[model samples]
Target: MEKITSNQNSRVKDWKRMQTKKGRVKSGQYVIEGWHIVDEAIRHRQTIKELMVVDESYLGALPVDDTTQVFIITPEIAKHISSTETPQGVFAVLDTQDYHEKIPDELQGAWLLLDNIQDPGNIGTMVRTADAAGLDGIVFGKGSADIYNPKVVRSMQGSQFHMKLFTGDILDWMAAFQNAGIKTYGTELNDQAVSYDTVKPTSQFALVMGNEGNGVDPEILEKTDQNLYIPMKGEAESLNVAVATGILLFKFVK
Candidate 1:
């Protein structure tokens, strides 16, 4: 393995750039820290561009193949590349294209559609919950938190590797799902909305979750086959978006 001791090294500088959305797009790769996500990447045989470790201590714990390029970095270099306050001392540069998948011509099984959700933690939890509920995929629309964001990746706990993820216009995807005869449901608290429990659970459907502050976009809600709301019995004005998503998503599972 090669050793990277200086933060000024060209490779280290480039890897650090992946901490931002623009940098990730420019390089066509993103960095995932810690061992759990790396294990998922290795288990799924995703195209990992590089594996960086602070020392040899983690090598035995990692599932690295002959094709993986391994690097040993000083603690300073590891801190420089990491986004978290306490660095994991290990990271991986994974090709973003490896996570891309073509949207199916027809919507099958359960799908979660996120609309402009700005919170990275919320997005990650929704993905994790969807995966746990055995949902089919998640469509991250424009304005939503970047799926490759480090915080989002950490919160997702590698559940993303278990489901299909797509990025694009949410409205277009909704139209496609509707055309495929799958019901499109949006979560919103409004007079016209019905309790989420009122709707019968089906094997195939698309659930639209909106921004944390504004709820679903009015226009997108209009496009939904039906707008549903969770019956909150508490004094709180509203539930956290991630919490609401979990409550509603599991209710959809057969």
Candidate 2:
């Protein structure tokens, strides 16, 4: 095992860079902190390139093989790499999985499509909800938050490992679903939209959730087979994107 005590170490600087979208893209890797997520990565058989912990004692029984490099980082190094108030003292660097090229020839099953969502928390919540709702996968459209964002990864609570995630044009996905004989629903409140409960839940469909301030893109909604709205009886004008997603996803699944 290697030891790194200096925050200025060349490798430490590389790990810090993983915190940003551009850096993650350039390196083709991202860093995940905390034991739960790390364990999830291991159990899910993700390609873990390296493990960094403050103490050797914290390395108890991890299933990493000899191919995975282990580094003993000082608490200062942990703080340098962590984004939270208190560092979990455990971190793992994983190669980013590129699903763009791996998209199935024929897309099937329920999928959650995010359109221009910007909040890491909201993105993470919807992902966890989709996983809990047993959706086949999630497609991150062009303007959605970065899935590998550290905050998003932590907020997902490891549910990311349980589901397929993809990135692509929402319109393309809509077309693919159409070709597969699956319907696409966009969340909106236009005159042509109907209440969400009006539609019957099915085994396969695509649900699009829009931006926090703006709803689904007009063009995207125009392409959807139907548009849905959640009726509100209370004075509340709207639901948080994440909360609304959970409600709609559960309704769409059998």
Candidate 3:
């Protein structure tokens, strides 16, 4: 393994760049910090390119093969590349999964479609919830938060490795679902929308969650076969997008 002590090192600079979306896109890679997420990446067979740790002690008994580069980085360097307030001193660089050019020949099972949901924490929570609910996949629609964002990844708590994730236009996915004879449900509170519990649960369907503030796009809602609204008995005006997603996903799964 190689040792890197300087924060100015070119490789160190490259890892730091991965904290941004542009850098991730440019290099086709992203950095994940914390031992649990790194271990999840390893166990899930993600294409890991490099692993960096502040101490050699972290190297023993790792499942990585010889091809993955290992580095001993100083704690200072770990902090420089870390997205958290307290650096974990462990990091992994992984190649981003490119699903843009490939669409599955058949769309099956339940899917969650995110329409312009921008909160990293919400996105992450929804993803984790989807995984827990045993959804087949999630489509990150246009205007949604970047899946590889550091904050989003951390919030996901490694659940991303457990399910399929895609990126594309929301309308296109709706069209595809229509072609596949799968019903797409949009969340909204306007007239013509029904209580979420009124719909029968099924193995194959898509649920669309919208922006935190504005809700689903009007055009997208119009395209969905049905629009659903959670009936709240309390005084709360609205539910957090992520919280609403969990309730709906579990309901649909049941």
Q: What lDDT does the true structure give each of the candidates? A: 0.88, 0.91, 0.91
User: What's model 2's lDDT at 251?
Assistant: 88
Clashing residue pairs in all predictions, respectively, total 0, 0, 0
Question: What are the per-residue Cα lDDT tens digits for candidate 3 across 1-254?
Answer: 99999999999999999999999999999999898898888888887799999999988745788899999999899889999989888899988888554557898899999999999999999999999999999999889889999988998988878888899988989998999999999999978999999988789999999999999999999999999999989999999999999999988985
lDDT of 2 by residue, 1-254 (tens): 99999988999999999999999999999999998999999999888899999999888857797899999999999999998989989999998887463457978999999999999989999999999999998999988889899999999988878888899899988999999999999998768999999888899999999999999999999999999999999999999999999999888898
Model 3 Cα shift for residue 225 (angstroms): 0.7
Each candidate structure's TM-score, on Cα atoms with residue i matched to residue i, is 0.96, 0.96, 0.96
- Candidate 2, after superposition: displacement of residue 43 in Å? 1.3
| Weakest ten-residue segment in model 1 by summed lDDT | 97-106
List candidate 2 segments past 4 Å from native.
99-103
The lowest-lDDT stretch of 10 consecutive residues in candidate 2 is 97-106
RMSD (Å) of each candidate, 1 decimal? 1.5, 1.2, 1.2
Clashing residue pairs found in predicted model 2: none
Residue 200 displacement (Å), model 1: 1.9
What TM-score does structure 2 among the candidates reach?
0.96
